[model samples]
Target: MAEPAGGPPRAGLVSVVIPARNAEATIAVQLDALYRQTYPGPWEAVVVDNGSSDGTRAVLRSWQRRMPQLRPVSAPEASGANHARNIGCRLASGELVLCCDADDIVAPGWMAAMVETLRTSPAAGGALERRSLNGTVALAARPPKESDSLLDTFGFLPYPAGANCGFHKELWRRLGGFDESYRYGSDDVEFFWRAQLAGYELGFSPHAVVHYRLRDGPLAIARQLYCYGRSHPRLYRDFRAYGMPRSRIGEAVRAWWRLLVHAGDLAATPERRSAWLAGLALRAGRVAGSVRHRRPYL
Candidate 1:
């Protein structure tokens, strides 16, 4: 957990590390948002470019020239975002680490809010509230205000979305960062569970907000759901091993029921409904892929 050489001291707070892959379209917007942060604290934006074949490198270079705080690190392998994030964490010098995806947009006050909350609390990791881009809904159930303990926050822990989270650098190192063996999903779940078991404090910050973009079309939505479903078994196994709550069966059933109910909404429109059904088919395909390639978490 010592600061890497040639960088600032470990006391520096909140390094924002973004792991990006083929994000040429939105990386600039995210970088610009980072530049506009009002935190005024010691921070750095580490962009781990994960073998992006797209013009993502060009975008990062342009941003780097404009902002000295923006540091670009190349990750030539296509191992996935988790690997890129590990590389970023290793290179980062801040005492605390914040992660953001390239496609998402962080509010101007987001960084300052989380940092302040973490500094005041004894939590190892802090959660930020998330709202969808289309203004559809909040991503997770809001936690009650009176709860001061991590156990009271356990229900909200499962709600910890990867994009809006912050953690202490020492705790992150102790937890071994992210498990790279996970190829497509559940890396966040695995890491958070490990952190909780290690007695690391977890807290929530509703003021820190991020806008997450929804999947583009029906095909994309279905693919995402299917991948999520396939990853559930492994997540359940991990949760069980860590003595954490397991909701795999319940989640799977609810997802199926929701899909059935929403089937009518999508089918109500002839043109768009077909696209929705196609997306469902893609989800099914991903589920099949997951089953075929299922790997034991242990």
Candidate 2:
């Protein structure tokens, strides 16, 4: 359980993978956090810019001069986050891979914690928590439980937010990286499940934290919920089609329902009733996905 040797002494060389599209506004903040890390190990940030028409490229260029550790790679194909991440992983030279979104801020000691945990544990990966804009923090939902057997963990795998997870380079390659067929969310879930099924252990590290910035407006929140609802059935269908267990469908449905009921919690004012309405719209999308995929729920 000693720290993995023959790499950078303190922090190790962690390739921080960032997949971004039109993230001109927040990418700088994320990079700033990376540059300021208190963990003084050799590391690099590989940002894959996926067909951003905005000034995202320019912003990255601006930072490249200021932050030598930042490297921007272009992925103009629009293949999605998974595609971009794969590109970054291939280009990365570090022994460890840490994934993050373009819109998140990592804590100062984030990389240090992930390196220490992965080095000491038998886990193929480590999970971290995220703090939402409202200052509410929640564990990244993956692996179902701390004591889950490796295979069962695959059955109910919860993913560390792509923004807050870390894994060894070789293990990532063995799992074949994220499946690009899923152009958005759930790719993380699918990849993690496959890794667990293949006998790789996954664990959690509370210190590797990030602040997730939710969209500022209620309408944006509603849109995000709607997308989640629409993606649920697709996730389940893919899960079953690939021969993984079909256990989480009911949980997905409940999540949709909970979102509908708690839409008010995200709204800032009574005038923002549209957010709740939007939540209903998202719920309908989830139902449609369920029916189209014919995924079973009890």
Candidate 3:
């Protein structure tokens, strides 16, 4: 890496591509956080709306004066974040592209940290924190584990969450962007895995933090985890040829057995009940996914 005189490392215009759909409630907070960034380089935020049926567009319109660097566009033709992200990345006129969710808040030095990290690495993932945005119930349902520098998936190469990751624009073009077929979950996982298979190194930056929002309530948590569970088999099916390991039957049996043992425990606390519902939903989804994707993961 080269630096000019006493200045920081060389960096170009960074386009922060955000994919949004009906994010009228939380987008403003994320946008406000972006506005308060401490990165000294030139950057712009291109928010692609994926068929928002609410006041999402209206909210973006209202923020024009407040954030002149903000560029709001439409990708209503597609129905997923991957599609919206592809459109936004294509339209972004920057050397680097940093992606974040419309609902999460980024740290003040996030951009700077990411920029610094990418100077040496081709792709990088930012750390995620849950306590800032989630309450005890949400946290209880999905307890926060300390995040690893790289995320492990089914014994395959580690990858990053799409909510906080970035890469050079050339790499995006080379990889053909994210696969839209993964409409719900594991889009990020698949993309980063493909990148690694294509010979690009994926890195992580703890300094670049994102306050991640969790799905609250048992219903919401169950639904989200179910979707996640469904995606796992699909991922396994797609990557197993490349040496991705299969789920252990012994582990799966123990999981279900434990759930069965506690099935009639009406005296369980709300937090414990929430965990039970999440576990049941995820297992059911894995079974459904095994049938749907023709790959047995559970």
Candidate 4:
């Protein structure tokens, strides 16, 4: 497929959509990082204020004076992040669409690398460098050295971090945007699976990097994992549409055992405890979700 022609040549405008919800402290840094991007093509940043009660709106408005390419939009329904993202995307003037979270810092050259990859490849995710709030790099969830697919969303070395992924605007329209019903998580996972099922190859970029802030503490991480786990039943049901078997019982049992052993380990540091509980929460959530969706997903 050819790069969709826009008023801008070379690569056309790359629209970056950011979904913000009470992210007053972090949104400005993300916008600043976008301002620093060396991507020469025409690009725009659309921030969808997803019912933030903080000063997120004022901060975005303030940044507009500095980054004229930035556009502020609203997703006031208190729906889902996907809804906010779709809203921002519809407001885009570019053919290539990028999605980033409100709390990430894009590396220099991030935009150019992702846009170039999507220009030549089907779908692409920029590399991610995760850090704690104190700026320490996370030991896990590191970006892969090669490209990945929706199949890799679990039990694999590579998967697209939603904060660092993008694809063609046409592709988004064809997929009908993300499943807004997925309020907790896995909306991106479903989209990736749908796109790959539609035959679009998912690509990865090492040079296109973003610094992500990991969840702050134990409860935070555990809650995040719980939501992810609860989303699995629906995720698996969606996968069945593409020919996966109905039963994932055996695989789920093994995973449950693994989490049990992990939680029983002696080392009890906050981070380690968090991981252990998170694993358990995920298993519990998957089981609950599986029951709710009437699929033996767990």
Candidate 5:
């Protein structure tokens, strides 16, 4: 049986912040999922349109009628997603904030699970790994579609998909929200690392799930990888002293080795090949970024 409204939402109200950039094609799906959350409490969705030239704003405005809780804001001069997120956070009235993506679809009960995690944790600040308030993060799976139940997220790019994660609004303010200077990825990573150093404890919610969209097409993957690679150096620059590893230094060589070993096997399937090519592009971008930034990143 489902826990009543008295279950794990002891935490204060939740504010879902979504940063959108020309996402008219899919924002409605996300909004629909948000509207269906079962947590019967005060909650709001904040959407920040970051210089979108399309009908994105129109779509958002239309949704506002149905979801009065959905607040729409614009960052016409902003340059990155993080910037938009920061803006949305500032406009938020809820003490608890959830950073959701404009394209992904969150599962039902996700909000409650996240709230439970924070409300029941032993500390004031922490992250939930899976979807249960008291769930063991050590046994959680990898980021959305990366892998199936990877045990520990220590090695992979696992630190709670920013799109599906939530936190106390005060913490967001204290940490200054996400770094808006970045034009690419890793902004979430940077914030998460800094938060951990600031003594935030992480919780796991096995039920708080979001169906994340993966970059797949050749050009799409390449662009995503390039941006991700380019942004990585910034993360290191900001958090190396806080223990962000330097393993990225040999990323290219390792990537090549993996390619050599799995070339034939990967060719056996179109999906595998597509992913393999994306990995190669990412490695290339990583190497280029290291040289460009004069950092031992790739």
Candidate 6:
């Protein structure tokens, strides 16, 4: 578990895989941040264009001139971020692979921290900061504070957020990559959980921070949270045999009751209204997901 050793061959090459889809507006910023990384190690950005019909390819073409290590590939066979990640990782030519989202910006020295952590840990995830890229509305809509440690889902195994995670190339092949079927959220959660169940240790690197982006508007935030909630039921259904905890009916009832108690907040400030909408949407999604996935989660 040491840093990639110096050698004539591609010994220490770190491949940063990014999955992009119609991210023309934000991807350039992400690529700019990647170009400014202070890792000081040999790293390549393997950007997989996931069927973007916009000017994303144009943006990538422009950055290619600025970033010599930027290699853009197309992944039209599949439609999800996980699918693009799988495609990008398969084509990556590096000992270590780091996966990040196209919409988020990595902090300077982020790569260095992740590589430094991977020197001792099998797989690692970084801290996500919401304050940097988000405004008051987006921040208020999603109030959960980012954790320095890997997230523990449903009282189950700790898993890394897909946006800022790194692992060895061999481990990715062994785990058969991410589940492409997970078109929604929690793909990273499922992957890391499976990795731990298969005997690999997942670690946290607080110094490797990624400035995570929140959805722009109330509707966008609702959709994201609903998709996340819907995905959790599917996760529960798949991992319950491995002792994944189930959602409690009492808790669900209490959650609804609390929402009702705070119904007045919907008419208050924009921040309060956003928070109320987000809470209601998430719970509704969980209920809908339970029915869709045939698992009584809520």
lDDT of each: 0.66, 0.68, 0.87, 0.75, 0.68, 0.87
Candidate 2 residue pairs that clash? 141-158, 142-158, 142-159, 143-158
- Once fitted onto the true fold, the runs of candidate 1 whose alpha carbons sit more than 4 angstroms away are 1-9, 121-132, 135-159, 244-266, 270-298
Q: Backbone collision count in every prediction?
A: 0, 4, 0, 0, 19, 0
lDDT string for model 4 (71-156, tens) is 88877876788888778777778889988899879889999889888878767887666543432212222222333232255542
As a whole number from 0 to 100, the lDDT of residue 214 in candidate 4 is 71
Q: Candidate 1 lDDT, tens digit per residue, 1-298? A: 1123335437955788898889999889888888999997889988888888899998888887899888888887657778988888888888888888898888788898778767854333333333445322111112123222222222424434567777777777877878887656666767777776777657677666766665555545555655654665566555555554544446545656766777775646543464445446534644564466563221
RMSD of 2: 6.9
Q: For model 3, how does the per-residue alpha-carbon lDDT over 1-298 read when each residue is reduced to its tens digit? A: 0111212212588989999999999999999999999998889888988999989999998997799888898778879889988888887877788999999999889999998999999999989988989877678778887875877857879888899999988898899988999987888999999999999998899999999998868789889889889998999999999988999999999999999999864357777778888888889889989999999999
Task: Please identify model 2 stretches exceeding 4 Å from their true place.
Answer: 1-12, 121-155, 241-282, 296-298
Flag the better candidate by TM-score, 1 or 3: 3
Alpha carbon deviation, residue 274, candidate 5 (Å): 1.3
Model 5 C-alpha lDDT versus the unseen true structure: 0.68
- Tens digits of per-residue lDDT, candidate 5, 1-298, equal 1111212222457788898988898899989989999998889888888888888988988998899888888778867878888888887877778887897778888888778876854212122333222112111111222323212322532355567677777788888888887668776776766677777765656677776665435456557777777766656666567666775436557778997887784556555665566667666776676777777676
In Å, residue 256's CA in model 3 sits off its true spot by 0.7
Q: Write the per-residue lDDT of candidate 2 for residues 43-123, one digit (tens) a residue.
A: 888899988989998998899899988888988866788898888887777878888889878878888887787785434
In Å, residue 253's CA in model 1 sits off its true spot by: 5.8
Clashes of 5: 19
Give the better candidate number (3 or 5) by TM-score.
Answer: 3
Q: After superposition, how far is residue 213 of candidate 3 from its true place, in Å?
A: 0.2
Q: Against the true structure, what is each candidate's TM-score?
A: 0.78, 0.77, 0.94, 0.86, 0.81, 0.94
